[model samples]
Target: MVKQKSLTNDNTTKVEFNNSVQTIDKSICDDVNDTVIANGMHLRHTMLTLNSFRFTTQLLRSLLMGFILLTSLNTKQLAQSSNLFNRNTRPSIECLKNDRFYRDPNRPVHKIWTNIECSKYFLCLDGDVFEFKCSEGLLFDVVRQICDFKQNVDNCDITADDAVNFENFDLYTQILFSPNNRNPNGCPIKGTFFVSHQYTNYQFVQKLWNDGHEISVHSVTHRGPEIWWSKNATIEDWFDEMVGQANILNRFANIRMEDIRGMRVPFLRIGWNRQFLMMKEFGFVYDASMVAPFSNPPLWPYTLDFKMPHTCTGQNCPSRSYPGIWEIVINQLEVGDFTCGMIDSCPSQLNGDDVYRMLSHNFKRHYLSNRAPFGLYFHATWFNNNNYLEAFLRFMDDLQKLSDVYFVTQQQVIQWMRRPKITPHLNTFDPWGCKPRQWESPEVACSIPNTCKLRSRVLQQDRYLYTCNECPTQYPWIRNEFGLD
Candidate 1:
């Protein structure tokens, strides 16, 4: 097995090694299978999807400690069968890994002591709302109740199946929806925010994206792929479907590159063609177009051969939901993007209980494995599920419980997937753009608009993104360091 180590000097480089890390070296995988069978940790029906892992230092340290302690305990009482049973089958557990108490920014870091005696870390299926919890753990649900029994946004109902629930032991997760598209003046908008009504929408997304919650890019109008990707479509259709989106996004979010970070194929077109690779050529980091193993369709990402972020010519990492990018030969689990369907893409038949069950399954899969990224993919239109926004809020509360895991933006993870084999900091600055000159006199490289858009976050800043006359629906970049972008 090959392993990578992150070393920092003048640069950060990932060096591959032979058996340097957690060793499970058997090309045939027969040894691992045998060991699993012998140990009785065999696969169960519920053991399904897996999230991709970064193998962080914490994980490595925990594994090392567990190994060292197991070795010491075993050798300390060698020769006695009773001792072996006592050591390996202790009635207790090992100390937690890199576990830190969550604290408020204004407060002190208080120690959160825990003795996991009866701590059952399981995904709980409430009658209607589901959440993650460890029995006897703190109750950490209801960060903000966005929905009520009426399924209203901020509706104050709290009726029979209205409230979302999660035990205190879990963490709050971030959720962001790549917006849909629109046709303006009979032209498809491109490179802009799809939903262009309110600044609050953009502000919310900006905050979540900054917080490491994912904020992916959907199509400009979210036109079904038939119109967007079809070969039979005319130039107008292409523009309306493709460039239109780019232009709109450019106007809204103002993303300069124009290519969106991720997208779900309209009508699941790519699921049949498996052409998501085509998107990479345009600079998309990844696509959330597929489903996962526990998904309604139930496909395994391990079967896909993809390992990195990709363009049209290359393959990409398999999502936990829909599968097949990974080499069908090699197995690496990928977490798929779950979604909220305010529109018709997926059926909205799941009761609150059903939805909660699905989410519980998502977490349970991660808990069973070494833990990886799980994308709670959805659409802003999902807010339509109920008249009020309580359901979505409830969903958010439940999803946030996996604090130990990272909820990254589509771009961040994709950039990581594009993780270079050479080394980081090679350029010191990104190779894509001009270097900033704070001390040097600022030059007016481009023309500013005569009238800036009302949504410009940069007005408070140095007035950087907004032109005097131009108003981008959203900036080319995400909110700059100060939300000005």
Candidate 2:
């Protein structure tokens, strides 16, 4: 929303500007150091929140595309003249201020947030997301959590105030890139997107979709049962929420709506079979409303799914009650509704920050592990114009930086699940080498040939190990890749 002027002159060429994007500061780049550093701390977290994702700046041109070398800033925003031995550490206080991502060496500031890669950082440009060049703050946040640090800010040789800046000693988890680089066409990537979904940033949604992020419908109206979810929810509500959501989403970017491909229950609340019925009506490829009893998502400490393992035998697997719908249960393995708090009917009215931490933990963990889609249950009210919403979005923006986790709709996951449901041939090293938990087949579908359905059941392995009979091959899928085999 902020505006800035393009300081680049007529002679400024992309080649020339690209050459100068590496420097952190110049004489003119002053004014907002603290803001830049703090922001950078948050931005750094975004870049490295989830270690499972590996971001590559591949130009997805029609033909054989050339690679674009994206430049990010050094983790240390400020040049520590005295703290040369700090090594990879930067002052938290200063680094948290006016730091930039994908910032130009010549120009060191992000005028606005946007999806545009930092071709050149000029004091004049503008956008929302600065750039995903590197991850510094990410290391700080994740490491601080799992690791134990006791530097004693003031108690040490340095004063308490010095601890915020001179502190070092880090790293809890590091990124491990998967071997698969030839991702599918619908894979996740950063780009400007535009879409037309209900009460959503249609343009933002569309941009995210076009830019390779998963675009989906949150709800038809994004309202509760009385207004949009009720048995008597009206055509108007449908127009405002359901149809409107689809229309906006369909119009999202220039992409065809036929591949928009995802949906979730508006309020994470659905009637008996209402969600399934709606998934059909909405033409979604998958529905993520199936948060059954167990879900082995890759993330933890917030939402964890621990269920008793079952068995998936020959034809007697999990039964499928509906067509093209997978029941995605939010397994609160770390902590969820039962512990911290579940965003129920009045989630939007909630006034707690713990909700975000809980949600973010799952997202970060899943991203790091390249695990399955994280089922985030939130109500429309969660995005209301309130402090809660502001904090939530900020937290989300940081989460986005953590990893290239696909922000898919339930439909998309369902579609992926529907694609040739083959179990990974069990290998000796496959988690204690135990057989996959079997699904419960329906009485009617017994030995029915092609119609053999897979029922929902989580067969537990040993202590801390479990997989779904329905999706055993890839017990946890990330970036469309499964680890089951």
Q: What is the TM-score (0 to 1) of candidate 2?
A: 0.32
Worst 10 residues of 1 by lDDT: 160-169
lDDT, model 1: 0.30
State the RMSD for candidate 1: 28.5
C-alpha RMSD of candidate 2: 24.8
**What lDDT tens digits, residue by residue, belong to model 2 across residues 182-231?**
12222322211112221232233332333334555554323322223534
Q: Distance (Å) between predicted and true CA of 1, model 2?
A: 52
| CA RMSD of each candidate after superposition | 28.5, 24.8
The lDDT leader among the candidates is 2
